[model samples]
Target: MKPSVSRSESSARCPRCGNAFDCAMHGQPFDCWCREMPPLPADRLDSSGRCLCPECLAAEIARVAQGRPRGA
Candidate 1:
C-alpha cells in the first residue's frame, strides 16, 4: 500500500539510506532533501508526490555528471 501524504509540507526520502525529512528542516530551498543537490527528471516523484533525498539524489547527479553510466 502507498503511504499517506502529510499536510505539513513535502519531504524526501534517501534512496540510499531510506531517511525521510523535510528540505526546509535541513536548511534547503526546495521541499525535498535533494534541494541542496540538483534537479531531477519530471518523473522522479513518488506516489505521494515528493522528491528523493539529497544524498541519494546527489549520488545520481554525480554519477551522471561523471559519465559513469547509469545506476552507478
Candidate 2:
C-alpha cells in the first residue's frame, strides 16, 4: 500500500505571487485559518486550484474592488 502523505506541515507556492507559504489546510481543511476568511471571487481564481497567500489574496481583492462601479 502507498504511504499516506500529510501536507499539514508543508508549504505551497502561491499561484498569484509564487511565494511559498505554510498551508493550514494542506491536509486539514476544517482546521485551516482560511476557513474563517471570506471566499475569493471567481474572477480571482486561475486554472490552478491552489490557494493564494494572504498578501496575494488581498491584492486580488483590491484589484477587483478598484474595477467595480463606485456604487457596486
Candidate 3:
C-alpha cells in the first residue's frame, strides 16, 4: 500500500491574496501567474526558488493586462 499526502503537507501560499493553498503538489505542473506575470518558462525558477501564490500572481496579470496599449 501507498501513503497519501495532504495539500498543506506540500501546498504553497497564494502570492496575490496571501492565503495559503496548494495548487500543484503532485508531480504535475501548470501555468501559474503566482510564479510570474507572463509566467516564466517551465524551466525557469523564481527568486525564492518556489512557486508564487495565486493572489499575487493574479494581480500581476491584471496589472500587465491594463498596461497594454489599446491596440495591443
Candidate 4:
C-alpha cells in the first residue's frame, strides 16, 4: 500500500524513526526525491508504504550491501 500521498506535497514522518520529512512525490516541477537514491532490493523494501528519511534509507541500502538483516 503506497502511502496516501496527495497530488501535491505533504508532511510525513518516517515510520521507522518517527522523524518528520516532506514528501514531494507528486509535487510541482519534479518527481519524488527518493528517485535520487539507488533502487532498494525488492526484498529489502519497506512494506509499510511510508517513505524513509535519508539517513535511515541510506542505512538500509548499506545493510543490504553488507548482507546484514534488518536491525542487525
Name the candidate that leads on TM-score.
4
Residue-by-residue lDDT tens digits, candidate 4, 1-72: 244443333667778777766777557866767888888887777787778877788889889889899856
lDDT of each: 0.54, 0.63, 0.48, 0.75
Off by over 4 Å in 1: 1-9, 23-36, 41-50
Any idea what lDDT model 1 has?
Answer: 0.54
Ranking by lDDT: 4, 2, 1, 3
Steric clash pairs (candidate 4):
none
Candidate 4's displacement at residue 62, Å, is 0.8
RMSD in angstroms, candidate 4?
A: 6.1
Model 2, range 1-72, lDDT digits (tens) per residue? 232233335677676556776676657444665666666677667657888777766666666768862213
Tens digit per residue, CA lDDT, model 3, 1-70: 1222335655675433446666653434764333434653333334565555555455545555577422
Q: How accurate is candidate 4 locally (lDDT)?
A: 0.75
Give the residue spans of candidate 3 off by over 4 A. 1-7, 14-17, 25-45, 68-72
Q: What TM-score would candidate 4 get against the native?
A: 0.73
Looking at model 4, which ten-residue stretch has the lowest summed lDDT? 1-10
Candidate 2 is scored at a TM of 0.61
Per-prediction TM-score to the true structure, in the order listed: 0.46, 0.61, 0.43, 0.73
Error at 26, model 2, angstroms:
3.1
State, as a TM-score between 0 and 1, how close model 1 is to the true structure.
Answer: 0.46
lDDT by residue (1-72, candidate 1, tens digit) is 233254335465544466764556444443433444666554443456544556566776777668675565
